[model samples]
Target: MILAIDAGNSRVKWGWHDGADWASIATVPLIEFAASSDHINPFSITHGDPERIVIANVAGEGAHQLLVNWTSIFDAEPLWLHGEAERCGVRSRYDRPEQLGPDRWAALVAARAVHTGPCLVVNAGTATTIDMLSGDGVFLGGAISPGIDLMRFVLHEHTGRLPLQEGSYRDAPRNTLDAIETGCRHAQAGAVERMHRAMGGNPLCIVSGGAARSLLELLRLPSRYIENLVLDGLARIALSERAVTR
Candidate 1:
């Protein structure tokens, strides 16, 4: 059995897979994590113990410790995943490969598994990251920009007058709130579209992260959504290591 965890900026997603299929999968907002990690169990209270646990953490130290705290009760220590030069057929193009976010790297690995051809990997969450991958599994680096929520948040935080809450996305917004939201969506969608165009051929756009659904309808390129690809890549990495060791 293998456990995979993706600790993103705003939430934490986890799943446990037993070779053939996932035994369990769940997500918890970071707001609830302090209590969940410290008091209640974050992974699984029922599953005996995971043979291997792989994690991709981009939230920060607190999240790093949460995994640490969970693995304390088990015999196996969690393998904290970081971006590398190459792994599982995907090679990175980042100038400083390790500097690339782990979440992004995991998504690239997942892209390699899901899309055999070139792909534009888009993860729209606290921050939206769009990365390009060549057909042969070379991770041609991409871009990062403010997500829909982050765009709204910055407007609310930096400026005066704008409300802190987000409004609905509109084609032609009637009011201020909707206008802000609509503009934000356009930017998010535009980034994906631009990346797809840059890839120059019709490439599969494998989308994930919290805002994936919102961006799905707006994107012009062929797209598919995987709930949390970071988790999928974690599972891939774990299985690869198991095969090597065996």
Candidate 2:
């Protein structure tokens, strides 16, 4: 079996895949992994001794060492994804390819595997990122902005009047809560609409991550929601590399 881990700023997600299909998946507070190893067993969580473990972590505050230690429980070497011009099944066009986030790369890889046309992948998490992939599989650059949570956090942190609140997609905000929700939704929707315009109106927009559904509900343009695309991408990369080695 293979295990794929995506360690983000607010949460950590893990997926397990047998040779033919994904068997299990789950998400937990990032703090769980920071706990003592005796508190939870990595091998027990996956229910298998993972042959290979791949991680795409953007929240790099001792997480690398923590993962390294956890994977050692299975005696498996950890493969940390790094940005590259090309790797697995996707190519990057970032001016400095190394600067591209591994999570973004993984999402792009999954987008290409699922759709064979020009695509705009929007990942809404700690930071919202929109990445474009041409029909021929060339990764054109896209955009990045604060995620819904971050935007709300900034408003509360920067101002005394605004309180930190949850974000949602609502057509009409009748009250103050609704007003905040509307603002966040509008910000996300506006960014997506701009990308749609840039793509010339005929590209597949694939939204993923925790906030995908809400963003899709607010946006007027067409889009598809894909959950756990990063894990799928990691699985694809691991399987492809495994086949090549054979």
Best by TM-score: 1
- Compose the digit string of candidate 1's lDDT tens values, residues 141-238: 89999888889989998998998777898878999999998898999999889888888989999999889999998887899999868888889999
Query: Which pairs of residues clash in candidate 2, taking residues 3 or more apart in a chain or in different chains?
Result: none
How displaced is residue 53 in candidate 1, in Å? 0.7
**How many residue pairs clash (N, CA or C atoms closer than 3 angstroms) in each of the candidate models, in the order given?**
0, 0
| Whole-model lDDT values for every prediction | 0.88, 0.83
Scored against the true structure, residue 182 in model 2 reaches a CA lDDT of: 86
lDDT accuracy of residue 132 in candidate 2: 85
lDDT of 2 by residue, 75-184 (tens): 67778886779876578889999888889988888899999888899999878898889888888898999888888888888987887877444567777656787898
Q: Identify the runs in model 1 with alpha carbons over 4 angstroms from their true place.
A: none
Which segments of candidate 2 are over 4 A away from where they belong? Answer: 36-39, 167-172
Worst 10 residues of 1 by lDDT: 35-44
Best by lDDT: 1
